[model samples]
Target: MRKIYNSYINNFTGLSKEIWLLSLVTFVNRAGAMVIPFLSLYLVNDRCFSMPDVGWIMTSYGLGSLTGTWIGGRLTDKIGFYKVITLSLFFGGLGFIGLQWLDSFAGFCIGIFTLILIADAYRPAIYVASDVYSKPENKTRSIALIRLAINLGFSIGPLIGGMIIASIDYSSLFWIDGISCVIASIGLFVLLKPKEKDKIDPDSSIKKEGLPPLLNKLYILLFIIMVLTSITFVQYFSVMPLYWAKEHFLSEDLIGWLMFVNGAIIVIFEMPLVGYLERINISKTMATFWGGVFIALSFIVINITSWSGVLIIGMLLLTLGEMIGSPFSSALALEMAPKGRKGSYMGLFSMSFSISHIFGHNGGMNLADTYGFDTTWWIMVGVLIIVSILTIWLYKLLKKSPTFEGT
Candidate 1:
């Protein structure tokens, strides 16, 4: 027991204090993220929006997210990550606060788009910041810490959010979400001043570079795989709640507890898992391929049984897949980035996920509304199988790459 405890502590030892602070900021911001987990429920139950309308609204959210990441990446390169983060937090907070007043379909479309645009700009900046803040050796662990913070906060938010909705109302969720961002903004602004390296880059660096690394064929294929895999994984958030409610007649809090199970499992296991994988010198892409297999199996588990206990089984498998894949996949992207263009590369990396948001949520919801949740689950299994195959191909191709040959 003592040996295991010390090993776990050692995994956390080398990261910079700034990374910890940055992760704390992430936790605070995400801790109040009550609105998203239950957003579909709110739309269906409270606003009475049809599933098709919800899909369109989610599409707008994706567009906004896509645009936000692009702009944020450029802004991070030009003005610095600090300023970009500030803009995201402050404007995102105001947007969340403003969202409650918009109940009409058009209003929601515009509001969700604008709100996500502002909030998601934080994505690329934070990714770049995570890379910059840590020692090269500690980079993966640092990113894991940020993810842990996000997951830990996500775990708390849904559990508490379900209770809050039961007691107060969905509108209260918006207020708390908005207020938390505001508080996060204040904390970030007051405490975190990044080093001078974060400032505007020398334009000559881009000139010295030939084609951008993000435009590489290897990079593009990797991005596509991320999109497909993310699309499959994202349904858990977008449509899984509907599945639980409509199929099993679960209450709001029960759904929250289930979501909590996913997040908590990730938080508890991810860092140590990442550390162990790093020490073992495993192939990152191969790890991603295996993780995709688990993600696919998660969907398959639903069709195997109607027992509600299967939700736990699927969640556990999904969480394991996430743990196995996420950090190594991140290391791949970051490793591919050229020194001066980390923001641009990370921006492109982050964009893969944002693009999925547009397709994933809308497509999953549409499928659920059309064919029923079982079909949606089966379809996801098919999609993830493709993702897994592509990941394996990428892994093989990377083994031949001049850069990866040595590593």
Candidate 2:
């Protein structure tokens, strides 16, 4: 056991103090966030709100995220990452606590807006900090490790929330979630003190090459690729279960476990696979991985009639694709960023998912409802193919672009 542990520790090179701290912060932040998937349920079972009403309130949260992501990205560049992360935790905690007093739909909406806005605001801060703290060689692994922490928290948080909800009232879910956020906030507050003063001035550090004149350049192209892929990504949570429940005849609990399986696989396999994948070029690997994902995702479209076997196989492929795509996306974003604005680059990357959620959820639901789950699944697969092609093309464009040089 000791030998295995030592070997594992030895494999980690260039693991910085800041990365470790950021990972811990991510873990804590995600633990609090896991409560959100259950928020709709709490509104229905506890708050006496209708499903449609709860959905509108949830929409407010998405709006908050849209605004918060942009605001957070700017704030990370201006104020500093540590402060933004601190506020994220503080607001997240406050939002959870506010749920205690929530009675009407409007009250719930207000609380959700506050929680989502603040909670989302901190994300870009964390991403920028992680990117800044990292060197190029280990950047992919570092980001993967950070994601692993978030996934770890995701793995455990839901289980704990389920236990709490089963044993206690829905109110306890919010109370515990609030406390977790507070504790997470305190951890970040104490540990992640800014070292900006120790570093060179931002302007002196790396002079900014003012905005790239054309918005239709490589960076923008990459953003579009991500958005396309995210159509399938967001479906994992939003409509997949609904489709499974209605058509595949899967139980909600089973769907949850499948998601749990996805998370668990990522946490287990992500780090070990990092080195092997790093040996390949980022663009090629991304294309290949996403291609594989699309092919596997195609399996989901076939009507297997049995939910268990087919769902598991398709979801497993989806998870594998996710494991490949996520870290690669982060690394690619960092590579594409201009100097002194890693935060802004990462912030835009983060928005891909947020935007997808807003559209993908509503869109996928509408497609599934109007057409069928198979049609929706096939459409997403087609989108994934577009994403892969665009990613490869963008990689070529980025290689040729003059802006590749960091000013």
Candidate 3:
């Protein structure tokens, strides 16, 4: 037992202090991520918006995320990840505060759009920073550590957000979230200094040489798979809470606990699990396939059981799938990116989730609203099955390419 514990500790210890600081910043920021998880429920239940309206609003947030990452990627290459991350955290925090005053649909749309656009720009910058700071062999574990921080924060956020909602109004969610972001930004501003290599000039000839990530054929296929997988995965935020409340009559506190379970499971298992998988030389492609299959199974099991015990089991499966798939996908993107364009590649990769949110929320809500939850789950199963096939094909194709020869 001691030997195993020592090995796990060594995996984290091998990383740079910069990586640990970045993870701390992520943890602080995500710790206050109270708004989005409850956004759909607040819109539909509190604001009395229709399901379709909620979908459109959520889609608008996605649009902002897409645009944010695109610009952020370019900015990271041009300016530096440090400045980009600092500005994003500080300004996005202000956006969250601004959201508290908005009540009309147009106001909500504009507010959500602005907040996500500024806030999500942090994603690619952080990933690029991680890649820049870590040794090549530690890249995957570095990303996992950051994810661990995220999940740990998430484990706290929703559980507390649930209590806040139960006792007070929704406005508190925005305030707390905004406050957290500001504190994180301050911590980052004081502690995070960019290394010389990370300070690439925008107009430098080397920075401009590589093809844009979107134009790469292999990356495009991977992006498509990302969208498909995220469509199923993102429903946890968009629809699952509403399902628990309306369909099962669960309280907000209970729903919060459910979200907590998702985050907590990842916190406990993600690093060690990812380390084990990578150590075994599991192909990123196969890991993704198995993860997607488990994700699909999670939904299928939910459809089959109403018991809380079974529901908790289903949530565990969903988190396990996330632990398996999400970090590896980012690591794979890092592996495939050209040397000078890590920011662009990571940006496009991050956009995959935003695109998923756009379609998944709108589409999933439409299905649940029209055909019911059972139909939605079955359709997700079908989507995952198709995505799994594509993932396998992508793996085979990559194997044939000289660039991806040994992968």
lDDT of 2 by residue, 1-407 (tens): 99966655644667788898888977876775546656655665677775456546766666677678878988887777778888888777878877778788787777766777788887787777776677767887888889898888877676666566666666776777788788888898788776654361242266665563125366677777776777667666656656565666754355556667777887887776665567654463354346446444644535545545777777677777777777777777777676776667767877776676666656776776678777777788777767767766665665666766320
Score residue 241 of candidate 1 by CA lDDT: 84
How high is the lDDT of residue 329 in model 2? 74
lDDT of each: 0.85, 0.69, 0.87
**Would you give me the overall lDDT of model 3?**
0.87
> In model 3, where do residues sit more than 4 Å from their true spots?
197-210
Better of 1 and 3 by lDDT: 3
Q: Of models 2 and 3, which has the larger lDDT?
A: 3
Report the alpha-carbon TM-score of model 3 versus the true structure: 0.96
The predicted structure with the larger lDDT, 1 or 2, is 1
Residue-wise lDDT of candidate 1 within 1-407, one digit each (tens)? Answer: 99999988998998988889889999999999989989988998999988878888888888899999888888887777888997799889889999999978988999898899899989989988887777788988998899999999999999999999888899999999998898888888887975565232333145434347556888778898888988888788768888888888889999999999989998888999999988988887887787888898899998789999998999999999999888888878888777667778778888888888899999999998889888988999889888878887887788799886522
Greater TM-score among 2 and 3 belongs to 3
TM-scores for all predictions: 0.96, 0.87, 0.96
Error of 1 at 120 (Å): 0.7
1-407, model 3: which lDDT tens digit per residue?
99988877766768999899999999999999988889999998889999989988998888899889888887887777888899999999989988988889998888888889999889899998888778888999999999999999999999999999999989999999999999999999898865564243322236454578878998899999999999999899988888888888888888889999989988878888988898899887778778898899899998886775777878989998899988888888888888778888888998998898889999989999999988999999999999999999889998998877645
The local lDDT score (0 to 100) that residue 249 gets in candidate 1 is 86
